[model samples]
Target chain A: MSEKLKRFASNNKQLLIMIGVIAVVFIILSLTVPSFATIRNLTNLLQMIAPIAVMACGATYVLVIGGMDISNPSVMAASAVFGVYCMTTLGVNLVLGTIIIILTGAFLGLINGFAIAKLKMVPMVVTLSMMTIGTGLATILSGTRGLPRLPDSFSEFFNKTAVIIILLAVMLIMDFILTRTKFGRKLYYIGNNARTTKVSGIDSESIIMLTYVISGVCAGIAGVINTASIGTARANMGPQSQILDIISAAVIGGVSTSGGSGRVRDAVLGAFLVCGLTNVMNLLNVSDYYTTLIKGGIIIGAMGIASFRQQQAAKKGV
Target chain B: MKRILAIVLALVMVFALVACGQQAAPAGGSNQSTSQQGSAGSPKQDIAEAAPAEKPAETELKHVKMGLAMQSLQAAAFHAWADYLAYRLDYEAEQRGYEVELVTLNADNDVTKQATDIRDLIAQGCEVIFCPCLDSQAILSSVKEVHDAGLIYVSYCREVSHDAQGDEVPDLTVNFASEEQAYAGMVDLFNIMKEDGVEPVKLIDCYGDKTDENAHNREHGLRRAMEEFGYADLPVVEVECGHWEPDVCGQNLAPVLAANPDANCMYSSSDFLNSGIQKAMEDAGMWHKHGEEGHVYFSASDMYPLGIQHLREGYMDTAVDQGCYNFAVHAAAGAFDLLEGKEVEPVQLVLGTQATYKDIEEILATIPLWGNDYADY
Candidate 1:
């Protein structure tokens, strides 16, 4: 048993370090902050982390392929707005509306993918343009208004419990695709060296395109879940800050911004840490300015530690 | 298969950590009221029956926790109001000899974040919560949660949906007559422009984001003023929408200025956006000071610091202040009143003020503008 534990630790040294950091934060917040240790707080923090996690999880695939997607939040808002507008205004069924949301995100993702792969466009530029287009398309689709009064049954069925279940399923799917699939293995190869990966008989373009498609599907799921949770649909639900927050979650989870080294598991942990810190800070009555600074410090701290670990591993010739 | 097992193990370990960290609330009592009455009836009526007839003894002063959840601190108007509220809360707490802990949270303009912020406030054991909500309709579900937790909810500035009983969800609301502030500003602008021997020929309407209900209200105010002042037929060269971003406002204005060189007058929904509009106009060479050859008649709502400086310098013609300072005063009052179980108004209107370039000195000296507090900005 001791040897098995040691092997597990060696294999997941980075994840274990993150777990340790989270555990420390949890203990300190519980000890110092009022109402931070309660079941309600924990549950609330866990429930809200799902929307962020879904996007961050999908983002892990693209990050592993050495690509950036700043368009996830915009995709979420656009898809949710379109889906809800169809249901509320056009008298479409709720389930159909939900499907439409995901498909719309996928469609937009296809556009982004085709441009980046077939047209040989830069991922950052293509996604940034998609981001602007998505936000604009959402505003036009919703007629620059918020659609409210969702069916009670729809919202009622998609409450807090649904958040956890949805996130769990998404994490499982992403983990399977990343760790258990042949295509998933190729993403890392492409990230490490695209020319080498292409020469090695991998359809690197298709693999990259597929990664974006997965990202879009995740954003769609995030949209439906968020709209249902709030019971309202506006064009810009979470807006640009949410995109940055999603990226921050991935980076904090130790997902390499330059690509090729991360997991959905790590991103999930990062999501929890980000959400938990926000929840605790709100409860502790910290000012928003300080909260912003502290959040920056955590991201920087996480990246700095990861860099140090990489340097140490390199020195040891690992 | 081993990877699947490892994934399962990781999840279990995480859940175990969550279970290990779970603990109980502190010894202090939560602020959830036992009485789950309607908002209109709950605070004002209950306070009448329940509050002490007079001030309690110094030692008997009640300790209360409160929360102020803002949409964002991006806008100068929000910053001014929040700052003034923070200051006034301390002053009132000292005067009333009560202990008050106010936690101010900014949602960064995200409805999802704002909803979570509201939930966090509820979790923090706050008795009274003040929010100028992002989307009033969207926040209804969280409003239900707030009441379910039996806390007093006070909405600031904007009106929200009513409860099942047809009463508003907010236990109390400090509301502004949304259309009136911009209408007053427009009216003042038109009348003062006529006095100065300037007629609004071709006009431009720079407005706020369409997603905001308040922005639509400002649009209605501007149009109503146009119809009433006999300028409805005046051809508007451009109607630019700035999503409350200064750079967006400036960029939107630049092309419109170039496209319509004949445009002579402008109305902005929010004066906070005028800096961008100002820069855009300067780029177009149409930003000449008042009494100069190419000065445009400018009118806007909200007395932010930039508006104050422009009106003083004769670059801007008119501004209607949202009375954010007074709004803060009333909102702070309603917060403490609800906490102390004192009778509070169900809905109170905070009136707006109009300032013209001609009266900048007098108005700045005589009136309390939230912008005055941020003159250095």
Candidate 2:
């Protein structure tokens, strides 16, 4: 048991550190801010964090496979607008609307994958272009005035608890696939060294493309969840600012942007940490400008500690 | 290749589905062309049927095509204004027996996009263009283009800054006395606080987005009110820049409340920010409606539906209404004058109304609330 515990600690040192940071933030907020540690506030925080956490799960895969998708927000907006139109205007069933939303996101992801894997284009550039295209298409479909209020029953069915359950299920399934599946193993191998994986007769491009598709699907799910939460499908639903939070959460949770390393679970932890900071700051009535400064400082501090730990581990390995 | 082909086929299927859905249920009340036959009658008869009007010859009413370039429809208030404006113009044109084509575009808060939208409206043969510019200075070139085309340029809500090259100024500008209205609202709230015996009022100023011209004007108005009320040197416990977002306002107000737990009042630039302030205050156990113990007096502008509801519930002390109906009516009237070569009056028109909890019902009945249905208008 001791040896196993040691192994777990060694494997997830960064995650452990991030968890520690979250606990410290919670303790400080609880001590200083009245009602900060209440069940009501925590539940509110959970609901607020759900959409970003859902998207981070898919972003984890993209980061692990040596790619970046800055267009996830646009994907969310497009899918959400499309989904709302189907449900509200077309009078499509809830199940079909949900399917259309996910499919729209997956299609966008497929384009990004095709360009990067098959066409040999840069991931950042391709996704950036895709982002513009997605936003434009969303505006055209929904117009400036987004889809009106969805049916109450539809929103009631996808309530806060339902969203939380879906997020948990996604995290568990993604973590399992990443740790236990052959497909997941190839992603890491390709991310670490694509040339080596190719020489060993593995299809690296196919795996990379699949990762993008998974990311796209995740973004689509997030869009649906956001639409339900807000009760309106805005054309500019997923502002780029929120995307920055997701990326920051993923990186802080120990999903290395350099790729080839990280776990799906890390994304959740990162999301909690980011959300917790905002929640505590708001509870404490901290000025937003100062909160922004503090958030930046904490991110940098966390990254610095991570780098230091990595250097020490490298030295010990030598 | 098969995989790629499959992906392409799937995308095409998605687009086809969207197209079908669009056709099945057309969008409602969008600013599109609606053909209306001119009433075959004398000019005097047509003019009499329309609202209190100076009759222009039927020939002078050249099938007026108007364009409105809105900054963004993200905010419900802005969307309500744009929708009502379109409806009002359409109704007016139909009444006047003129073929009117209304083209409205949302710039999504991008200055460059707003400029492009203006140029596109001109190309679409818009005889009169009204834009609430995203960037006052950046839209000068587009305004110049509108002038060069001999089309009437009307600035709404925001005043466009004239270029150094001395290009043609806007034919007319219409806006609310934003600063004075905000100031009046604040002063009214202050009076309430004083009456309640909340001495030594420690106030928090939650201003609007710094980039917005109205925000600057409103802030000046608040200062002016403070000066007039002999509260210029009053203890301003905290000043938060909400940027017109409730979330940002909540975040900014939370810490201020913690530090100044006894803060008696708040002056927010708009109802959107007040909503955030209310939420934060409630969470902090500092929220109380007027006449209740520990009530935090609040003043705001843009008497949107939410603001009016807050007033009805006695949560707000006062709110200023930038009358959307009046704004649209005035702008449309100005466009008509320019189109028919009628003598135009003062270049700038300021309009607004202030409401309080005491007269909330009367105000609601008088003005169109945000999210009001077009049919109701």
Best by DockQ: 1
Instruction: Tell me, by lDDT, which candidate is best.
Output: 1
* DockQ (CA atoms), all models: 0.31, 0.02
Interface RMSD of each: 8.3, 23.3
TM for chain B in all models? 0.80, 0.80
DockQ score for candidate 1: 0.31
TM-score of 1: 0.86
In candidate 1, which residue pairs clash?
A: none
Candidate 2 regions with alpha-carbon error over 4 angstroms: A1-66, A69-193, A197-318, B1-61, B95-97, B148-150, B161-165, B237-242, B365-377
Looking at model 2, give its docking quality level: incorrect
lDDT of 2 by residue, B106-175 (tens): 6656443465456556655679999887655445556766887778888877776533134547888777
